[model samples]
Target: MLVILDLNDNNKLRIDMKKNKSSITLSSLCGIIIALSTSCSVMSKEYKTILIHGLQPQQLISASATNVEADGASYWSSYWGQVSDERIDWPSYERIEGKIATDWIWPKLKQFSEANLCDSGCVLVTHSTGDLVARYIIDNQANWLRNAGLQPLNIVATFDIAGAGGGSELADIAVSALTGAASWSFVIDQALTWWLGSDVTEAVGVLHDLKVNNARKISPVPDDRAPRLRFVADGDDFFGATKLFLKGSDDGVVASHSSCGASRVDSFGSCSRHIASDGQVGHQGNGVSGFMPNHYPMLMSDNYSHNSIRNAGHKGKVTVANYAANVGGKQVSFQTYDETTGHWFWKKQYRFVADSNRLSASELIYDAIP
Candidate 1:
């Protein structure tokens, strides 16, 4: 018996098995390909979305302990629903050393890599210190996988929510309070307890990693080209307590420089290279001019707090009154609504204020997913 396959004159697949012959039209061939693509595994592409969570108060208290109830690692379920296929949970109390990424995180990632689960590509959603951890992964995952005789992850992009990759000044302050480097005032003690759920008199494990300079020193720039999309908020959820410790504009916990992926920690009002003196939301511009390499700020809101941005709850409504070419620049257009007159259009800069309805930051981020 013999078999042969070839394209017919009519652009159809003609297969001959011994004395029997059959032809499949182009549409039929496409249908067959689609049907067999699953069994043909090697030809199919699988895309996965992985969620890496931020620091937990319980983890911050003790690296060796686990408090499932206090951990927000599973909060992504509310924001993204059931889209995430994998979740990477790490102890926020561990340093970015042997145990944190090398032992704890690596095993999970290695398993996924070895399985070639994301053969096509993946989108990572990380929050706070997870952003810092992801940068390390992006920098080393490929080499680590190849060294282990496995395939590397094809990370298409990363969504960094309240990213602390640039490090938070609060970490520095916390260390200062712990080491007695700075005066341990009543205010500092209260703030740390409020945030960490404990006195946190000792800065151990990951607290050192969260220090502004230290975090920046760890894989600040990744070799991978995956873009880091940042979602930031300027609301003071901590009741204006932690804000004094942070620089410029902040999402209560992290300063805008860190959240926006600024190359250097500074007082930056907006993530864009341009800023408006009159105060307008900085719509993140493309490229690496104003931000860290491969980092791009996506959404910004005055109403969204650090915690609210990651949840499914509706914060409230906001009105976009103007659109500008750049922050602080002349407004190119404007649209405002009034109770009596309805929407009025004109030329102005981009401005968001407390008013009519708009999507929450979580919804906006979810919608932005490709």
Candidate 2:
């Protein structure tokens, strides 16, 4: 279970690392131990790509969530079961906590990258809230990186899938449904279960941040000078078949407006991803109130997982374009992906951020860096 990446420092990852001293004991971790490059022998190694999971717990995601819904073709997460160089011990089934991001994730990331990376930096592959968490780090690089014993990290790219860009209406539903005025809908319950798999009492912080107005305060800036941020959105409503559209497009989980940051010019209040803080029950505002970005980040072949049955509802296969193919004549590890095998390459490229034309992780990680 060794996941590795081998890109140069051309990509940048903007992460959020707000300091906090909250001590949560995750009493219900379900006894899952997500190992991160555990080598018994104490030795230094070079690596390229790193893995960061999103909101869904690792135990039930990818290999596990598919069990919830399968049309028969195939279903795999972009980062599920894929070996990686670095693995963040994101709570397998709990909503994110700022302390985890700052106390554990930030330090571990810097330590791992510094100890294992070559000149070629690593590629950050994130999903859901993981994308937002990383953006928080970028938003506060000085304290998170330098104070933690390193200069700014040189990330190559970031891959965001169904990111909670402007938060979700579902958050509100998850909070009130169990006791909301409306009758308890089985569909909403199921979707919320899959989302956090925990009680509302345990989700106060997550729910607070998922609020539209609250989420906007910590949302990514319009433009960041770091990595190339590439976004992928899902179309099919996998969770409870709920067509809860934010602005216009939705994937049962996240609205397309929140994912692509587009399709909200004329649609205005009706089609925006923004959900007014105060609205009538069952009434989401025009979706334009909060931050409305105009850029739609995507891959050349169009990265929309769960849109097709062939790649499974949630899995995608991308043939890494090797700019250095002639020299190596093969897929460079850390910078490439083999669709047929669903594995990331791990060869060290010693890729550095050349001042000539070095761009941020294109430019994902959050697509905010450059």
Candidate 3:
């Protein structure tokens, strides 16, 4: 005989018995019951963690087409740990205008959602260009899935590490140089090496979409409800070689405006209007200066390089910030850290000062994970 057990949302258990040559042992029944009981418990809510990777040229040229968490975890695995249930891998070399989304990414997301995300809910973890990929998905997935007569994914939120959603100035320089519109310079060589492994003769494909103006044009405002939490850095691994070509403060590869999810592409110091990139006193007021709709800059570090921010082992020094959602299209302050006490003070206890508050990047990321 074949026996099966299942649990519904009501916590009620259902058993199915089917005629078969295979028999079920008493121990096996007990194990099944125990597993179901533990998994279906009211206190324990099941959730899947999904990872999306960024610009990796190597992934595009590989013999195999598909790359998943099972194939190998992303660089973020150090902090996220071995917790990825699924991964959305795409050909990084292709342009964002191509069928990369429909062919390479959407099918995997649809399958994963139907199989796991619809029931379990999921958290999206993305890095670099993956942030841009995620924004496109978040904006379109609901209507697309509904049209196909499929249930939309239950996405809790997105964690964007060194996000490039606002695009980078380096891409503009690259495209200009490759097209001969602008002369090639040392800045282009070093910047391309940092991002693509070497200086290239062509700046076609994904680089086209990564241009500062082009990226903003694609998705200026998101319609999705899921919150986008940005993790940004200011340290330049290139030692000022690539920084000169970039606008404002940068983490070698991406500028603060892009990584911080600013409303517009411009020179910016920090995520907050109240704090400068140099940790000096900055302008006051909650007025919208750098915020993208539904985008929040959660953590930042002047000591963290673009590569170091994702590695848990690095333990780079960082500062964390958060704000309440838009009420009538205006953001409100939520909490502030008191450096002396080493504790966060709520709005009611607002004692915020424009000073550098230090903490480990890993510590902040670990505390924020669901």
Order candidates by lDDT, high to low: 1, 3, 2
Q: What is the TM-score of each candidate against the true structure?
A: 0.74, 0.52, 0.73
Backbone clash pairs for candidate 3 read: none
Give the candidates in order of TM-score, highest first. 1, 3, 2
* Residues forming the 10-long window of minimal summed lDDT in candidate 3: 347-356
Model 1 stretches astray by more than 4 angstroms? 1-46, 67-77, 273-289, 317-358
TM-score computed on alpha carbons, candidate 3: 0.73
Top-lDDT candidate index: 1
Model 3 per-residue lDDT tens digits across residues 139-196: 8888878898888787767878889888888888878987899987776777667666
Off by over 4 Å in 2: 1-47, 57-83, 92-97, 116-119, 178-187, 190-202, 222-224, 237-240, 262-296, 300-370
Candidate number that wins on lDDT, 2 or 3: 3
Among all windows of 10 consecutive residues in model 1, the one with the lowest summed lDDT is 321-330
lDDT of each: 0.69, 0.41, 0.67
Candidate 1 vs candidate 3: the TM-score winner is 1
Candidate 1 lands at a TM-score of: 0.74
Judging by TM-score against the true structure, name the best candidate: 1
